[model samples]
Target chain A: AQSVAQPEDQVNVAEGNPLTVKCTYSVSGNPYLFWYVQYPNRGLQFLLKYITGDNLVKGSYGFEAEFNKSQTPFHLKKPSALVSDSALYFCAVREGSDNYGQNFVFGPGTRLSVLP
Target chain B: DARVTQTPRHKVTEMGQEVTMRCQPILGHNTVFWYRQTMMQGLELLAYFRNRAPLDDSGMPKDRFSAEMPDATLATLKIQPSEPRDSAVYFCASGTGHMNTEAFFGQGTRLTVV
Candidate 1:
């Protein structure tokens, strides 16, 4: 089974400060990881994905994530937080070898609050 | 930009009533997925289709829930007898059906069963 976890239920950060939303995964094989953001009353928007590439993956809205195989973690990061960046973040994972179902297991989600 | 579109942005119904949600996938996408979102469960895959064929539906309750892709572009999820516990936001996403491809999500339909 492939699963992902977002340890923090909520994260508070100040504007202009760096922010990190933690994520970890457990999969039987290599993992295809993804990051998504959801604003209140809006659909989830894809931020980025780590299929197989360099460890560092940059995404939309000045966001990036680093894939650490040894640590089984893919943490979303931003150099500077903004009030608009406050939203719910989700981490998802799928087994690299899974082609039949193409189902993704999503984390419970972490609510990020960027105080201005 | 191409995106998946779901109908009935919000639906409120009394218990035991049938509810149906529809989705239109992006053109040329071969795979479509239905998911339920709630505070407790987050996002869970209810069903999915590939090439207009049902691939997996294990996450959905078999008794009252049914999903079907009537054509290449249209998909529908039906609940015969909705209950209060079934209240949640249902989302539809479409992808190319290739390994590692990202799925584009619809705005979702918020269903409330009383």
Candidate 2:
């Protein structure tokens, strides 16, 4: 089975400070990781993805994530947080097995609060 | 901007009533996905379509849920005799190609079954 875990239910960070939302996964094969953000009453917005590339991948709204195969993690990061950055962050992994189908397993989510 | 669009931003209805949610994918995208979101289950993929063909719908309840893409532009998810547990935000996403590609999402339809 493929699964993802977001250890933190919520994260607090000050505006202009660096923020990190942790994510880890368990998969049998190579993983395709993705990060998405959702604001209140809105649909999820894609942040970035790591399929097969450099360890670090940059995404929209000054966000980025680093894929660590050995660590089994793909944590999202932003150097400078903004008050508007407060939202729900989700980490998802596409299962690599053929029988697992082409569905994404999303983490429980982590609420990010960027304080001003 | 080219983005996915969903109808009925909010719907509140009594239980046992029929409910329908609609989505319009991006013009050139070939893949469409339906998902349900709740606090307990973050985002569950209810169904997906590739080239107007049903690819996977294992996440949907076979008894009351049905999804179909009558045309490339429109997709619908219908729940007959919906239950209170069916209340949640349902989202529609579209991707250009495969799972490896990015999928854009709509604002989602908030369904509240009482």
Candidate 3:
């Protein structure tokens, strides 16, 4: 089964500091990883995705993620955090092959707080 | 902008009452997905359809819950007898069903069963 794990339930970071939201995955075949952000009362917004490309993929709002095949991890990163960056982050994984069907397994989510 | 749209942004109903949520996908999208969001379970896939056909619905409780895409423009998820535990935000997303395409999400319907 394809699954994603976000180890931290909450992450605290200071404004202007780099922030990292960790995510790891388990899948039978190659994995298609995605990062999404959600604000209060809103649906999940797609941030970035790792298909088959370079290790690092940049996304919206100055966010990026690095796909590590050996580590089976796709960690979301930002060079500098802002107070508005505070939100819930979710990591999702789907098997690269079609065998797993169309569903993508999502992580429990990590709440990120950027303190000013 | 092209995006998925869900109706009944907020709903409050007594327990045992029927609740129905509706979604309209993007114009050219071929796949639609239904998901429930809660603090305990996070985001879970309740059901999904491809080409207006039900593809998977195993995540939903079969007894009281039913999902249907009556036409290309409309999709509905119905709960015959809702319970308190069913209170949560239900989201609908649509995608092109092609490899590497990300699903676009609707604002979601917040259902509260008292």
Candidate 4:
């Protein structure tokens, strides 16, 4: 079983300030982690994924996430926050290819409120 | 430009009425998923299918909720006797065979059961 957790229900950041959304996961075998953003009235759009290789993975809209194996956390980060960046963020994880099914588990979600 | 498309972006109906939501997955994608999103529960996986065959639907309410992939392109979720608690955004997603691949999501259908 693969499960994810986003501790914070809401995060507020001032514009131009660095922002971080925390995520942690528990899974069997290997883990395939993903971050997604959802704007108002829109579907979730892929941000970045940490499959293998580099621990720091860059994604769309100047967003990035670092995969920390020991800590079992993959936190999404941005150098500077923008008002438009305020949205709902989700963290998802899947059991390694060693497993199957649509068993993609998602976190409770974090609402980012970037103040201008 | 391939993406999942969902129909009836917004639907409002009284309780006890049947509600059907449709989804068209991306071409060549072999897996389809149905999820419900609400403020309280966040995102909940309702069901999923692979190659038009249902693999697991334990998360769904078997009594009133049913999902089917009639064809490769079409997937539908039906709810009978919908309750107010059922009001939420239903999202449909699809992905290829690769387990590591990411799933593409539809804009979602906001179903409001009054």
Candidate 5:
């Protein structure tokens, strides 16, 4: 089975400070990780994805995530936070493409509040 | 931008009435997914189709819920005799279903069952 866990339900950070939203996963085969952000009354927007590449992958809005195979973690990070950056973050995991089929699992989500 | 398109951005219906949601996936995309989002349950996959073929619908309620892909671009989800519990924001997403591809999402249909 494939699963995703976002340990924090909420995270608060001051403006211009670095922000980190934690994510971990468990999958039977190689994992494909993704990060998405959702604002009120809007759809989930893709931030970034990790297929197979360097440990660190940069994405939109100056956001980046580091893929750690040993730790099974793909933590979303930002060098500086903005008040507009506040939104709900979701971590999703899918099993590597193969002959088998499994549902994509999404984490419970973490609400980020960037205080000014 | 090229994205998934969903019809009837908002719908309100009485209990026991039938509700239908439609989606048009992105061009050349082979995979389509239907998901329901709520405060309590979060996001739950209702069904998905690949190449206009029904692949997995186990996540949906078999008795009252039905999903089908009439063509490569058109996918539909129907719920007969809907209950208040069925009220939620339903989203449609599209992907290539190939290696290392990310899915694009629609604005979603907010269904309120009164």
Candidate 6:
């Protein structure tokens, strides 16, 4: 079974400062990881995905995530944060195998709060 | 830009009442997914369909929940005799068959059961 863990329930960051939201995964084979963001009363929006890449994957809204194979970690990062960046984030992983259909296992979620 | 569309943005109903939600996926996208979200359970994939054929529904409750794509454009999820525990925001999403492709999501239907 593929699973993801978000270490923190919430992360507080200052505007214009860098921010990091940590994520780790457990899968049987090579992992397909993803990050998504959700605002209040809205559905999730895709951020980025790491399939078989160069480890550093850049995404929308100046967000990026690094896929560390040995550590089993995929942490989201933003060099400079904006107040609008505050939202709920999720980490997901899809099992790697012969399964044609992708079933995503999502983390509990991390609430990001950016202080102005 | 093309995106998934969902109907009945909000619904409030009594226990034991039936509720239905609808979704229209992006044009040309072959895969459709249904998910439920709550404060406790971030996001749970309820079902997914490929080429309008049901692929996986293991995450959903078989007794009360049913999802079907009657046509190429529409997908519907129905819950019979809903309980307060069923209250949550139900989301509809769509994507291509490729693993790297991103899935687009609808605004979601917030169902409140009393």
Model 6 residue A42 lDDT?
86
By DockQ, who's the top model here?
A: 4
- TM-score per candidate: 0.97, 0.94, 0.97, 0.97, 0.97, 0.96
Name the docking class for model 6: medium
Error of 1 at A63 (Å): 0.7
* TM-score winner between candidates 2 and 5: 5
Candidate 2 local Cα displacement, residue A21, angstroms: 0.2
* Tens digits of lDDT, candidate 2, A50-96: 98869899999999999877899789999999999999999998864
Give lDDT tens digits, candidate 6, residues B6-62: 999999999999999999999999899999998887789999999999999998999
RMSD of 4: 1.2
DockQ per model, Cα: 0.63, 0.52, 0.56, 0.66, 0.56, 0.61
Question: Model 1, residue B6: what's the lDDT?
Answer: 95
Error of 4 at A40 (Å): 0.8
| Model 3 CAPRI quality | medium
DockQ of 2: 0.52
Q: Indicate the residue-level lDDT of A89 in model 3.
A: 97
Candidate 5 local lDDT, B2-108, one digit each (tens): 98999889999999999999999999998999999998998899997888887888899999999999999899999999999999999999888864778888999
lDDT (tens digit, per residue) of candidate 6 on A1-116 = 88899999999999999999999989988788889999888888999999885989999999999888888989999999999999999998877465454867789999999999
State which candidate, 1 or 6, has the greater TM-score.
Answer: 1
Report how far off residue A97 is in candidate 6 (Å).
Answer: 2.4
Candidate 4 stretches greater than 4 Å from native = A97-101
Q: Identify the superior model by DockQ, candidate 2 or candidate 6.
A: 6
